[model samples]
Target: MSDSSTVLKYTPAEMMIVVAARALAGVRTVFVGVGLPNIACNVARYTVAPDLELIYESGVYGAQPARQPLSIGDPTLVTGAISVTSMADLFGLYLQGGLVETALLGGAQIDRYGNLNTTVIGNYDNPKVRLPGSGGACEIAINAQRVFIIMHLKKRAFVEQLDFLTTPGHFHGGTSAQELGIASKGPQLMITDKALFDFENAEREMQLISLYPGVTLDDVVVEIGWQVRVAETLSETAPPTTDEIALVRGRLSSGKQSGGTGEA
Candidate 1:
């Protein structure tokens, strides 16, 4: 068990990163998205999953970036990579070829079935807030053996329906993705600051599996737009260890370009 006092020293964002990294403890290969997912993968390499191979969309495979990469195309990712190939080969040979084990993604909006929306906040043509459209997320989500989504849990982001489906999750639940010939097993886990959710039920709806130490069931439920299901044996997420907190903080503070706005 981690010391309670030490765990309180870290911010929620730091905790989220630690929790997300822990999810990849045994994963051998990961298709890493920028921002928080990148940090999580980097942290995992230093801690639990040292042999983890990180693949970026910008053609780097088995990347062991010395510092945080600004984007998928950042030069740091190519520094110590096993193979630096073209974007086409990386996507076609690795992702679509079904060689990647897991993909880590983030979204502006997510529905009960884990469908993601990163295109726009409102109407597509007019729009309330224009977002960075999917770069390779659609393909990665569709082809990775399994996918993990990491994002902040908010009422607006966790909606009943997405404004645009940039990436397919379990479409309408059940075996929809399989039926539609989507190669990957859609959205296996969702890691948020408040809680960790899993698509363990038959219908593939997000189920509350565990809560962060200070967060309550009500806290998570109130933020979700839909009536979410809770696991029968819900557990508390393990608090970030002193070492985990230190590693995450050290990496973030190392002057590497973290793509997103300090969300991790």
Candidate 2:
């Protein structure tokens, strides 16, 4: 799947889920967020991480959903769960207690330091769009061992500064979470339709690590609000294989592109 023509066979949304699913190759437990993240975890369970334990916000731990769940509260997640606890116990014992290995999250906007905004799109007091505000995402970002975020590349979505900081990515800068005495390693990976990124730098900025098979440097740069940094040894992401595409499509009923930058 190295050829751009081959990658074009699948929509960018399918590519994102395939890549996101592959990212959990060795991950054991994942705090699965809604939508794309949920589908990705299920794909991982069938592919890369067969023993992957999915933890949902609605108190279902070690979930084995038969089909793609509509939301965190979807009944499918609870049917085969290892254990279902109270929301308070789930958050306090697993997330905040530092048992979660990784979390897959999504947001409307993300800045250089990886700060997220899922609140008001404009001014909080007077907003243009009132998005679904943070519901456990704030705690997930701060408490999960690390986070993997998924979003399509877009100018306003990848902003210079978030309208309202909902989750702590890297915070002020590198090791800032440690400076603030937070134990979670914060965001380790971010998957986009056009590229993959990591914060493995002195400043912990969202550094581009690889481009999708058909995407180019200019393609990624034009979508971000700030001067995006590319990895010194950048490479193309492996395009989705036939089996991987089948699995992704099987999990995502619509196979639609992820929501674009949340009205940004």
Clashes of each: 0, 0
> After superposing candidate 2, which stretches have Cα over 4 Å from the reference?
1-8, 251-264
Model-by-model lDDT, in order?
0.87, 0.83
The TM-scores of all predictions, comma-separated, are 0.93, 0.91
lDDT of 2 at 12: 86
For candidate 1, give the lDDT.
Answer: 0.87
**Model 2: per-residue Cα lDDT over 1-264, one tens digit each:** 132324337888888988899999989999986677777776777667877898989999998666567787878777567899999999999888999999988899999888889998999999999999999999998899988989988898999989999888999878887898777788888899989999999998999999888788998999999998888989888888776766576534543323321100
* Tens digit of per-residue lDDT, candidate 1, span 1-264: 243336547777887899999999988999996777887887787667878898999999988776777888788787668899999999999899999999999899999999999999989999999999998999999999999999999999999989999999999999998999998999999999899999999999999999998898899999999998999899998898887776677645374534332212
Root-mean-square deviation of each candidate, in angstroms?
4.1, 5.9
Clashing pairs in 2: none
Single out the weakest 10-residue window by summed lDDT for candidate 2: 255-264
